[model samples]
Target: MGTKWITFDLDETIMQNPFGKWVFPEIVNMLKKEADTEEDILDLIVSEHLQRMSEERFLEAYDWDDIITDVAEKLGAVSAIDIERMVIKHSEPPKIYLLEDNMLDYLEQIKEKGFHLAAATNGYSKYQLPVLQKLGLDKVFDEVITSDSAGFAKPNPAVLKKLSDEGEIAAHVGDRIDHDVLLANRLGILSVFVHRSLPAEVLSLPVDKRAEQPSCIRLCEEKWHKENRLREVPFMENECIPKVVVQSIGELAESIDFIIK
Candidate 1:
């Protein structure tokens, strides 16, 4: 039988959220609007804004409206609806790092080879799903698992367990060695490490496989650079690692074929 399942990691694997940039300001604005003083506003953002998305018990009761009301009410606000309106207005056309053109083609090729795919990444679905839709490859994957959805983020065995349960993932491809590769290995699932250059933190992990040519990643970096938009695209300068690193997603098919055989 074919391997059938391939789980992937988002953010630096499929997309990248530039540091110090996001929709935080809008949330902050809402806090400021409701609060009587700056101290009160900061307190609300600190108290309510910084919670783990996977806290299901908290999130189950805390929908978007609840989140707005909770934050606003913490600062002594009157209307949750107004805060939600501002939040949604600020959240309109959710910001996303777009995927490379080759991504769609590569995913199609992988599916043609009979592989089922899923995404296992950190962050809530609100932030993550938009990027998938922007990539236009949302329909390609059989499932998209998120840390928020799973109630745990990467490097956590629980996330991998949820990924495996989705179908039958034979392999997981990602950029972080500790969070992605090592986690996969812990569960006895094959791991493929992407990016030719890795951070010292990631390089410290024992990686099973590596790849450098991440087209989707490259495109996102290029767009950010071209747009002069927000944060700088982090690029690795060294090429000294001693592992086989391919330049494109299509190359993964060949590498996996050899490994599976």
Candidate 2:
């Protein structure tokens, strides 16, 4: 395989939220308790920004003031200033997917093989760095670049390219076809898709093949679960794409064995 560089995405690829979670909207809805309509509106404003951060090229241009003011008007607060309380509430984490056990060890194995390990995350240093440190990846990854740092996010290959060493053949491993695998394809790097939580039936075949089956969409309804709550998986999203897929970083470690060794 001759793979020399390996980059990763943070949110779902490495670890997920403490719970199988929805990001901005779900958190905003939760924190919008009856303190005041102003408080709720403020939460909505923050949620709007976080949603934009994940979905768009937020670093290139963002009108935070406009987002806040518009949200204030929609919530009948009249002024964005009216929503601001003196006592200060910090912004909640945009996403806080906890690291799973041994995900780091897998990377360590990759590192031992002498690959230049790096991270290309949608999240910034303030949030992403701490998680890496907690997972003991603070020193493991040669570079930890982010959307805020790079001015672009996933599905956009620019971040990956910018963070790449420029001399090495690369592979990127992450959990999303929309973001990670797509980035790999666009950048002409090897793509390794990870699907840890899927049921055995849907995972009976590689994702690219399984995704083509009519049974794929149906399986999402029956098998995708966390905390005993079933939710529809975006199975169709994986279709006939990302020639490589694995369920865990340990699997990732194995897939890279030939190349790394």
Candidate 3:
């Protein structure tokens, strides 16, 4: 067989953008005047997005413009110009941080072992590309495939099929059990789950402070459940179960070797 490929999920797997997922909340705050309450607007935005995802299996089915425009029309409050401006302002490149120390070094070491590496993520190139550049990982991957580029998302075997076309995929690493593990299991590839536990400082932050920085609340909540050994989703089926699990990316190389044996 040709050189095997090792794929990774970008967002919570390789890096953490503390504020990336909180963009919608920030938008609700900006348009507070247009809606009756911030909570109402936020609920509408999230519900509408979820509805779209349900109908269109692709994660990138509807862009922000479509969702925001629909929300505005329902409320009949915000203007087109204001919505456009808010989207632009909040869409700036987010400050990204590596989830683990020596992330780049670890990836390079894996590459040197003769395996081709690829980043198979469920995101648009416009956002994911800048993240790789910021983390100095732009040169590490032989291929960087996003949902927008692949025209498909995780848990769908088609995304991995594209990567497999270049070379056989030996394994896939990601933080999500549902999306990442499920996708790998379906394709008969080794699935590695990297558990991202937040630092004590982040977990102990005041509730008010967490609210000030939107993603903190989510980070803290997830960490709490993990620390307590609780599962957010009650049951895990065979497809969703990862073949191997590690605490951090620093241990990823060893896990990959374990799978190879």
Off by over 4 Å in 3: 18-22, 33-38, 53-56, 77-94, 197-236
In terms of lDDT, which candidate is stronger, 1 or 2? 2
**lDDT preference between candidates 1 and 3, better one:** 3
lDDT of 2 by residue, 1-261 (tens): 333678887777775432123333433343344224645554566566656654453553234445655664565544323112210122223444335567778888888877888887766555455556655667778888887777777767677665554656468887766567667877877777676765576578754465444455443323323211322334334431565666778866766765333
> Roughly what TM-score does model 2 have, to 2 decimal places?
0.64
Instruction: Decide which is better by TM-score, 2 or 3.
Output: 3
Backbone clash numbers for all candidates listed:
1, 2, 0
Write model 1 residue lDDT over 99-167, tens digit each, in one string: 344666777777777788888876567655655665565887778887668876665668757545556
Ranking by lDDT: 3, 2, 1
Model 1 collision count: 1
Model 3 alpha-carbon miss at residue 51, Å: 3.3
What clash count does candidate 2 reach?
2
Q: Please report how far candidate 1 places residue 164 from its true position, in Å.
A: 3.4
The collision pairs in model 2 are 16-97, 17-97
Q: Give each model a TM-score.
A: 0.58, 0.64, 0.73
